[model samples]
Target: MPNLKIEESNSLISKAVIMTGEAPSAEAVPVSTTRTGQMMWKDTFYAGEPDIEAVFDVDTEAIQLYQSQASIKYGSIAAGYSVLYAAFLAMGLYGIASVCLVIAFVFGVLTRLTCKRATAAFNTGGIHMAITSSCVRYDQEKPMVSTAIAVQDITTCTVEQRELKPYCGLFGTNKTINLIHLRVANGSSSKRYVGVKDPRNFARLVMTIKNRPRSAAPPVASSEIVFR
Candidate 1:
């Protein structure tokens, strides 16, 4: 005979247990290898059905590319300011030369800080993305950020790839970096999911959900339903 036990949280069912009357003989009990906090398929079902989910690690190449671009833009501005500073100094305009020099130093420092922060962010576990019939959700574990966007609000999904040249002595080869960019109906408002695996497939999944016909049945509240 076995007794059934139920676990509840806030008066809501969370888990159940079955206790046998007789203790299991030595070697009869099964060994379990599952770890706590590790994500399973069921964890992604928190929102519900017709959902496409993916977990990705940070894309180093993409981060590098972004940093490089930022550096180039800021570096160019700084270089221009530096030239102006020198010209002003030669023209005996001490006040303007000092101002230009200060501007150049600020831009140079900003470029370094931008790249450093970007690198730190990626070092944290990448991201988890889920796209459902009604919305798209994404969250990052470290730094703890989350966002949910209604599918209907999404206007565009695009995948872009760029070649990156890394310096490895004299024989280094170039690598390609892929990025998925999304746009909303609101002007100049957009979001990007970077360093994702199979970005094209993810984009297609979003498009399909966005274009999906509305269901006639009333929407079920996520909390009320239990997924087995």
Candidate 2:
């Protein structure tokens, strides 16, 4: 087997796996990274195998890499209100004590209301997979579709898993699947976490790489979309 070099970026945060098997006669095409953050929601893991696989072909099929939702945070609204309260308190020192208290109370109420609204508005959905760089080897007909995402777009590649014990402890009592968060940056240096089916093992494999940086990558076309 030829030592195939899978290079996405020269950064130290990208992931590449060079397995023994070659791509099934063709490289799969890339698909759109849906910005919509909605996913199939259920209380517990579905009573089935966790769907996880590499895209041999995407255009003709669907590959369920990992299903996780983005976190819907509402603390922003409450935090915003708290800022207003602080402002009111500053004014209180200027001989406007009663007015400051009233403003604080009003702002606190507004913040609470805003938080409630956030619970409905702020929600996390879907996994962030580097679809363009994730690929397999194949025939020349199936050229890999390159995404517009430049090397700067990715922060790191991560592998996730369903841990029996939560790292934070006492919060997630039940064992659940989680993505090994990869920090990928776009333009403003914001970090994003990506979830893989088996993160622990993936991380180990990544660390095994003698010299490499974590960064962006993804996959596929004409094929069977199977969810593990």
lDDT of each: 0.55, 0.31
On a 0 to 100 scale, what is the lDDT of residue 61 in model 1?
Answer: 61
Model 2 ranges off by over 4 Å: 1-130, 133-148, 151-172, 176-190, 200-228
lDDT at 158, model 2? 43
TM-score of 2: 0.29
Which residue window of length 10 is worst by lDDT in model 2? 59-68
lDDT of 1 by residue, 60-163 (tens): 56665556666777878899999999999999999999999999999999888656635544654444566654677776555556888886676666666656
Q: Which ten residues in a row have the lowest lDDT in candidate 1?
A: 219-228
Number of the top lDDT candidate: 1
